[model samples]
Target: MKILFTSFLYLIGGFFTQSVAQPARHRAAQDSLTAELEALRVQGHFNGFGVAIVSGKGVLYQQGVGFADAQAGKPYDLHTVQYIASVSKTIVGLALLKAQELGKLHLDDPIDQYLPFKVRNPAFPDVPITLRHLATHTSGIRDNDFYLSKNYYLRPGLPLAGLPMTFDATQTFIPADSAVSLPEFLRNSLTPEGKWYQPKGFSARRPGELYEYSNVGASLAAYVVERACGQPFPAFTKRYLLRPLRLRDSGWSFRQIDFARYSRLYGSTTVPLPYYATTTYPDGGFISSVADLSKYLHELIRGYQGRGTVLGPASYRELFRPQLAAGNFEDRNERNPFSESYNVGILMGFGYTGFIGHTGGDPGVVALLFFDPTSGIGRILLLNTSYDDRPSEATMYQIWNTLEKYQHRVGG
Candidate 1:
């Protein structure tokens, strides 16, 4: 009698468990997201664009729209690669953090410790600039104002000087007397001995005390990583992050990758633009496809979930958190409390508060990669054309709304 009663209780317990638990959710359909992206491509007059949805385990879906080569009639596919612009900065950030984890460098170390040249804010030479400051854009560094300078075109090997003229017929190219390497560009632009040195390339405030956006600072950080790690920046990054993440369709240089797979960039007028590279490759130089980046984002999400081995959990935790608070720049629109070199506290589109990611834009490209650590879901969008006036904030809002509503949730 006792055994029969116990078996009855067990059966009842199992029934209750089945009744109370949530039913497994079928994966959302991908058709809606694909159709929406295609519509957006048409509406925006984009030459080509790619979108991807990712979760902790892997990519949910990735789709490409429009023509990679309108003349050739090559329809853009998930494998069509293009420059991701400033999005590359985030990769550089991860590389630097990886270096730190390997005991190759420290975040608080002074710039002079690793850089071949001594770089000081001319206004506050007494205050030292640290890697932390550079990563947070608080290094008191500023843009070169290159176009306004006489020698801007005179540095033959300085890629930035030639890029504008190469891509736009209206822009004039002045011939240079000599070629300059990446290291030379930095030395000339920052040191007192170099002719291109300008006092205006720094803020009046001390390092780590203010915010000023700077490509120079970011590129410098990458260079420091290379010096500390005893390897070229691109090589180190490939071995450490790209190879491990299986982002095979990504690279920094045109010479290194399969150029045939590249999506030719377009202007607002639908004119194909010339391919241009930069000496500051670390700052805004990433050529990739949606499929490749989806893998990268998944790995990043895994790290956030404490299951990643590529980077220590503590490092990934600090990567997105606000590194500086007082006097830090905060953008309510992005829900970014502060800007780290590669990470931001993003509040938009993730369906949750306190998400993180980065955005990138150049003359003819715009890309965004964002993910929520709490939910382990993320979105990526890449466009291959630029307008006379950059797209407004409304575009991002619409994108977030659409993805939030339609993206398939997998394994959640």
Candidate 2:
């Protein structure tokens, strides 16, 4: 018995020794990554950004470099919050599948069954647009000029002159109070009976025939979730997705988060953009941070691996299942590993390189959230500045590529 007990003690001692050594190595790798990222930031055009390296196990590394507010000299750290633009659509994807799991709706069901108003492709008014079509960006819906001109509303009390006019003229900002509700906005933009409707609001192709990325279509899917589940989109997502993930810093609007931590967005290092909100909030308005998103990405990685807690194994399978083929896209990006347009699964994206995730860019926000299914490693980049020029855009890619190079080392 004494001999057995000493053997057990030695085994325990060896375990502790290895555990301590692993973290020490991890810390050294993290420090090296941090230093390299900081150097890249100094040379890049973005004012500030946040990053995370995660795996199915959990967050491997997370950090923020540069300034959240350059004028104020506030460091953009792990907790600095900002909108992730279209990356928000991934949460909508989760919500849709969760609602489906609860028997509220099915992906193949025609959207008109849930929406208060009817939506049909004028090109094929007889063809029903399914929730699946919407999720896969093949619903034949189009984001017409009205969507660009009317959907964005500037937050109250900002000096208009200080906003970046050169950023995008079509992304016009109106008064915040003038903004309509999501349902109202969707009805007007999509239905011929509504005022903002355009003949080109829908595509000529039949539903599910072509892949045309539409912010309006994405938001409409979320609205369907709301109607089927009998809860507002924000409330439903918060209850099922955010609360479960313990993403305390993420929400659909500024009101739901600590506004003080919100990073000031920029068109460039010198061009600060005024705060704005999207009526189609589900498509591009999710506010979050590197620290919180790391956890969410970790959950997604686990979900992809069939061990997720948020939904059943079946739902995760559907969520990551590729929904498109070569013919779905008019022009596919066959080269860009980060291009989400290569193929789609529900709303989750598949890159040409087999990376599964999404990429998002708004006026002042650029975000990339992708994971390698083979390695179970994921990376996130959330920048608070726009990369309008080629050099700046290349720098953004450089940052992502840098994370790619180090993710395996840090995550292992």
- Cα RMSD (Å) per model? 12.5, 9.9
lDDT measured at residue 277 in model 1 versus the true structure, 0 to 100? 58
Per-residue CA lDDT of model 2 for 1-412, tens digit only, reads 0000100000000000113446666777777888988888888599999988888876777888999999999999888999988888899899999999999999999999998899998889899999999999999888888887788888887688856543576677778888999989999988989999987888888899898888888999999999999999999999998999899998999899998999999988998888888899999899999888888888888898999988999999999999888988898868654456778998887777787877787877888778888878888888999877777877876787777777666645
Maximum-TM-score candidate: 2
TM-score of each: 0.81, 0.93
Compared with the true structure, all predictions reach lDDT values of 0.66, 0.82
| List of clashing residue pairs for candidate 1 | none
Instruction: Report the C-alpha lDDT of model 1 over 93-156, residue by residue, as the tens digit.
Output: 7887899999998988998989888999988988889998888778998866552232223223
- Model 2 ranges with Cα > 4 A deviation: 1-22, 158-161
